[model samples]
Target: MQSLIQQYFPNVLLLKQEFINSTIETLYMVFWTAIIAGILGTLLGVILVATGPEGILKNSVLYNILEKIINICRSIPFIIMLALIQPITRFLTGTTIGTTAALVPLVIGVIPFFARQIENALLEVDPGVIEAAESMGTSPLGIIFRVYLVEGLPSIIRVSSVTIINLIGLTAMAGAIGAGGLGNLAITRGYNRFQTDVTIVATLIILVLVFASQFISNTLIKKTSH
Candidate 1:
């Protein structure tokens, strides 16, 4: 059994330990980055919606400033943002070359992107629902929480799925800077070493992770939605 396995899956067997470690590292980066980006982006998104011209808060100055900031950050490519923020990353993580360092860029890169997504999701909430809440004398905070967030839950889940998948791709780019993960494993051990099998296996694992995320997200959306 061992001999047969080894014959067909030599590369997988050879890099089994690396494959496990890198997969775990990628999960670690994705989980934490998602949490941080999720919270900040949600806040920024809500603010963007609340401060729009027709928003409950209706502060154009604040809205424009935040919108510009989000736009500028989102405009920069992830790879360049990773390099451009090296100094900040080093200061925060004490090293700009590992999985921890990678989180800095990963979170920064996704925050604006997720914020825009969340804003769009919230915007999709029905205006009549918001008006009903307002007529009931609901405060702005109440309307935002009970109306926008609740009504948009399904859309938010869908957008979150998309954001997470994008973050996974960004993590691959992070591997270029020694952020050891499937991406690093695929590139450094597989491609650079000419180990085609290793690359294929790594790519397959990433695909599995992505599909799993999408499935879970879709399930949650279905459960939450009417």
Candidate 2:
């Protein structure tokens, strides 16, 4: 067993601790980014939904403004966004490197993505359900929380799963700026070092993470569906 590992997966054995640490860093970045962005994105999405021309709180100006902001952010490619936002990242994290600093770009990059997903998800809620709630004299806030959100839960989970998968991929790119994750290992230690084993191992682990996240999300969606 040991011989086979050393032969087929030498780098895995050689950099055992690195693989573990990088995986942890990757998870750390993903978890925190998702939480922070999830809240902000969901809020923006809800507001966009509530204030749209057809929304309960109907405000074309607010909706168009918010929509334009989200679209602008989404238009910028992630890599440039990383370099472009270096000043802000440094100001916020006091450095433009490492897992913590990486969160700045990661969150900013993902908010628009997640917000759009959330908006689409919430939009899937039937207009009649909203009307029924309004007829009952429910406040817009109450209708949003109880009717739109509840009905949209399954779709929200589905979109959230896709967003998280995208976030995982983004974390790898974050490594280009020294964010310290499997991507860092893959690039610096694997590709740069000319060690195919490290690169392969890093990719395999990232795939596992993506698949696991999708599985968990599917499960939640199933349970949440009415």
Candidate 3:
């Protein structure tokens, strides 16, 4: 294996450029998607919770509709959703390949998942606080924006960390379809050419990235909450 890697070292260097480019692409895709989805998902989560049966703004009709929609979207596997949303991807980015084009599907794919996480996190908040806010005559939206957001910031950060890590993994899978990312590099240069070292290297990099993100986010959550 050492000799084989030595023989391909120069070629691997070229492919390594592609891997780096792919990693950057994946980062780009994940960051933008997280930004959009984070904002929108938080809103959706607040809405979902606030409009539930016991919510301050409870509305069975609306909550049921939103719930079903979220479920349906979340039910679709990421890979199939990639193909399914190709037209929208083209319309959004003018192409069905590359990192930018992948954003559409990634955002759509991640939003519901994040929203669910947000909902669960917020639900973990003490109801007494919400009740206290209600006694202060806070509007439904006010309760969510001020009370829930503030009180749940730590949980939000924690869940957001998880969501981000998952998004990174999805971004890699997106590479399988023409979306350039580390996953694409692994599949193309590593798997296609049977370059196991390339695959190992990409995997190690991703693991490091995930661990680093997790550590940083957890530290932030701890510091902020305390």
Candidate 4:
């Protein structure tokens, strides 16, 4: 088995190299999308919380528009979004079949999802704390920036970690569309060729990625929550 891969697939090592490269690509997509989505979603969520009926900056106009946008975006499946945003991805990344191209859809896919999570996390913040901020003459902006954002940091990080891991999984699925990564390798090279070894390696790599992320995130959350 080893001799066959070494001789026939000189790139067997390259496959491992590809695994690492793809892992890095996946991380790049996940982190960049998460950061952008985290900020935008946090803002959207804060707006959702602060502008709901009894919210500090309640505005039926703004609230309705935000709610509808989030709902509509969330309704679209990630696979559909990949195809749906092909032109945009090409425009942004100059190609629609590699790691860079993968990011555009990944970001669009995650923002609404994370925004919803951020909304839920922020909503969990104590209303009394928000009220206190208001009572102290803190502007709505100040309340969101300081009170809500700060207090919600731990939960946001924890949720962001989950969002990122989910994005990694999504990246694998993107392989079906030619976004070369572990999934691409698994499907195109592994399954098609009957090389269960490739599939096993890819799955193990993904599991390790998830576990490592969980470990690091759990530690951070514990430290921050303290």
List TM-score per model, in order.
0.96, 0.98, 0.93, 0.89
Candidate 4, 1-226: lDDT as tens digits: 8888776545456677777877777677667777777778777787888888877788999989988998999999899999999999989889998877887888888888888888787877888998888889998888888988889888888888888788889989997678877888888878888877777778788888889889999998998884
lDDT of each: 0.92, 0.95, 0.88, 0.82
User: Which numbered prediction scores highest in lDDT against the true structure?
Assistant: 2
The local lDDT score (0 to 100) that residue 79 gets in candidate 1 is: 84
Candidates by TM-score, descending order:
2, 1, 3, 4
lDDT of 1 by residue, 1-226 (tens): 9998677668889889999999999999999999999999999999999898768889989999999999999999988898899999999989998898899999999999999999999999988988899999999999889998999999999999999999999998898679989999999988898888888898999999999999999899989998
Native-to-model Cα distance after best TM-score fit, residue 220 in candidate 4, in Å: 1.5
Model 1 pairs in collision: none
Candidate 2 per-residue C-alpha lDDT over 1-226 given as tens digits, one digit per residue, 9 for 90 to 100: 8898799888779899999999999999999999999999999999999998779999999999999999999999999999999999999989999999999999999999999999999999999999989999999999989998899999999999999999999999999779999999999999998999999999999999999999999999989998
Model 1 misplaced regions, further than 4 Å? 1-8
Would you give me the overall lDDT of model 3?
Answer: 0.88
* Top TM-score prediction, candidate number: 2
How well does candidate 4 score on lDDT at residue 116?
A: 83
What does candidate 3's lDDT look like per residue over 1-226, in tens digits? 8777677554566676776787788789888999999999998998988898878888999999999999999999999999999999899889999988989999999999999999888887789999999999988878888888888989999999999999999998998877988888888888998887788778887898899889999899989795
Q: Is candidate 1 or candidate 4 better by lDDT?
A: 1
lDDT score of residue 148 within candidate 4: 82
